[model samples]
Structure formats: structure tokens, C-alpha cells
Target: MLAFREFVRAAYPLLSPGASITLPCKSGGGGMRPWLMLILRGRTRQFVNEGAIMDTIERAGFEVACMDEVASWADVGAVAREVDACDVLVGAHGSGLTNMVFLRAGAVVVQVIPWGKMEPYGEGFSGALAAHMGLRHVMYSIAAEESTMYNRYGEDHPVITDPDVFYRNGSNAKFYWREQNIWLNTTRFAPTLQMVKRMRRE
Candidate 1:
């Protein structure tokens, strides 16, 4: 997720009206799932209670689109051209479509990695491939500092609490970060499609 954070940071400076922010997803939910649940369930109001990460980004005054929401995933080749035209690309989890589009277009991509939940995307291969391809290292999306977890069992008590203590109660589980590197920041052009292909073959 460090890679994603750096990407965001780098892109943040470049972001302006009409900038493209490509968000990749497996269906709809990605690493932003947990936060979504919290907002929907009235557990938290962070990010302005946005329904999804894409929504939040859109509210930030940037042009955002989801690859999964497009006509078809197979059409990524054509879609990549569109992604390339964007100012920046933001992807979550294994990077899925974002990696493919960015690599093909030789555009900047920011990938998010979850801490606690490891979604392997063949870092070695992608890193090497992107490097050879000249993808830029941007930002990362690691665990946030001062992040707190909460329990569902505590109705009368605070719904949100520290993850450490909440886990002890055997209730809800949440992840919190304080400037941590659970996520990796990377910049590689032409990500290793072979690794992604290999994983799919598995």
C-alpha cells in the first residue's frame, strides 16, 4: 500500500480539474469495503460518509471512473487507451484492471495493498517489469495513523474502539494505522503481465 500512498501523494500535486482518476475493482468492493460498511451502518462518518471510495474521490473535484463499471473487462485494451489519457490512475487491492491499463498506456498507476489482508500481486515480477517499463514510483496507502477499531457487540458503549482491545473482546475486527507501511509504493512501467497471467492460470 506504500506504493499507492506515494502514488496519491505524487498525483495529488498534479491533480486539477479534468484530471483522470481510474479506480480498479474486482466487482465493486476493494480495500475500501470495510470503511464503506462503517459508513453505511452508521458506525463512522469519515470521508464525508461517501458511499464508496470513487464517490469520495469524485467529491474531491476529480474525474473518476471504475473499470468494473465499464462495458466489459475484456475491452480493457480499448479502455486502456482511455485510461492513458487520464492524468492519474488509482487502483486498489491487486491492482487488477488498473495495472493492466496503466502498463499498456505507460501511464502512472497507484496500487493499494491491505495490511492484515495480503492480496499477492506478484510484487517481484510487477516491480521488475514496471521498472523496466519506466513506471514512476508515486505514493502509498498504508494503514492510517490514529486509526481506531470498534466492536459491534457494544451497543450501549462506543461502537468504534481500538482494534487491539476490540479483538480482545471477540467482537468486530478493524485495522488502524499510524503512519505504517502495510502497503507498498511502486512505480513500474509495463507491469509484469505474465505474473498476473500466471496467477489467473493457477
Candidate 2:
């Protein structure tokens, strides 16, 4: 924890004392939380239809905000605050989910994973992170047809069968990360967004 704070301090030395990102405390001018934040990862894992995703999230009744690990200038303090304000944190299976350590209780962390057996990762690492942080975990598994990998290596490649070995090699992992992108089927993704929206806020 000390190491993480030090990293955050180094990365964002400019944070104001009260700096924070917040979802509106009321929705539709009513007494209920008006806006919820759905943070999309646009950095390491590229989403083919980013606008479509934002639209889907908005249509599901959430007010969406996006942060890219590579692109955004948002500092760790801001991100931690966003996680505190956020209802759902959306991203592919990656280290971005590690930021959930700042998430508030009952919030959701949605991990969108690839076709190659990246399970337990969502259920293992991110889920455990959420559990430890008092946050909820959701998964968005990319189907074979939805994954670009299906077209590149066919279904029988070791990339599909023995991801353990394939990923163990740095070059292979780089190639896989560079080439594999998920084409999300928004129709299938909306329900989960709605579920997050309706989840009782902490």
C-alpha cells in the first residue's frame, strides 16, 4: 500500500487537497442519485466501438465518464475518487482493474475478457480485488466469433488451447495483446449495464 501511494504521488503530484471525481448525487432532479459513472478503459485494451459503448451505457440510464490508462491525464487520486463515485468500472481483463482498490463498497467492477480461457482471472484476480475492496464484480466474456483471435489463429491454435504456455512467452503475449481485440455485441452488453444501474447504491 505504501508503494502504491508513492507511485500515485509521483504520477500526480499536482492533486489539490480536496480533488475528487463524483457522480451526481441526484438523478432527474429527484432525491435519488441522478447520475452514475461508468468508466471505460480506452488505454491498453482498445474497444472497437467506443462511441457505441458510451451510447449503450447512457441508454441504460447511467451517465458515463471514460478514462484511458494511456491517454487520460487523470491522476491516481482522481481515479481513486472516481472509483469511489463510480457505480461500475468497465474494462477488458487487464491491470486496469487493479485500480478497484479504491472502489467503494457495493460498487461494481466489470471485467470484459477475451475468448481464450481468461477465466478465473475475472473471477480470480479482479473478483478477489473487488471482494477485498467491498465491491461487486461483473464479467463480460467475449464469444469466439466476437474475438479477433478467432480469425487470426483459427480455433485449434495453442493460443486457444494452452493460453498458459502461449502467454508465458513474452513475444507471444505481446503478439496476442497487440492482435486480440473484442468486438462487443452491445445488445448482449446492455442488460449488465442496466443491472449495474439498478444495483442498490452504497
Among the numbered candidates, top lDDT falls to: 2
lDDT per residue for candidate 1 within 1-102, as digits (tens), equals 336533533453322223233444222333221111000111221222123454444433334454542243556444544454444444433334234323
Q: Rate the local accuracy (lDDT) of all candidates.
A: 0.34, 0.63
Task: Give per-residue CA lDDT, model 2, range 37-94, as digits (tens).
Answer: 4444564446777777777776676656666654433456666666555556788887
| Residue-level error in angstroms, candidate 2, position 42 | 5.7
Record all residue pairs in model 2 with backbone atoms less than 3 Å apart, i.e. clashing: 26-34, 27-33, 27-34, 120-124
Residue 144 local lDDT, model 1: 30
| Candidate 2 runs further than 4 Å off | 1-44, 71-74, 153-178
The per-residue C-alpha lDDT of model 2 at residue 182 equals 73
Compared with the true structure, the alpha-carbon lDDT of candidate 1 equals 0.34
Q: What is the C-alpha RMSD of each candidate to the true structure, in Å?
A: 14.7, 5.5
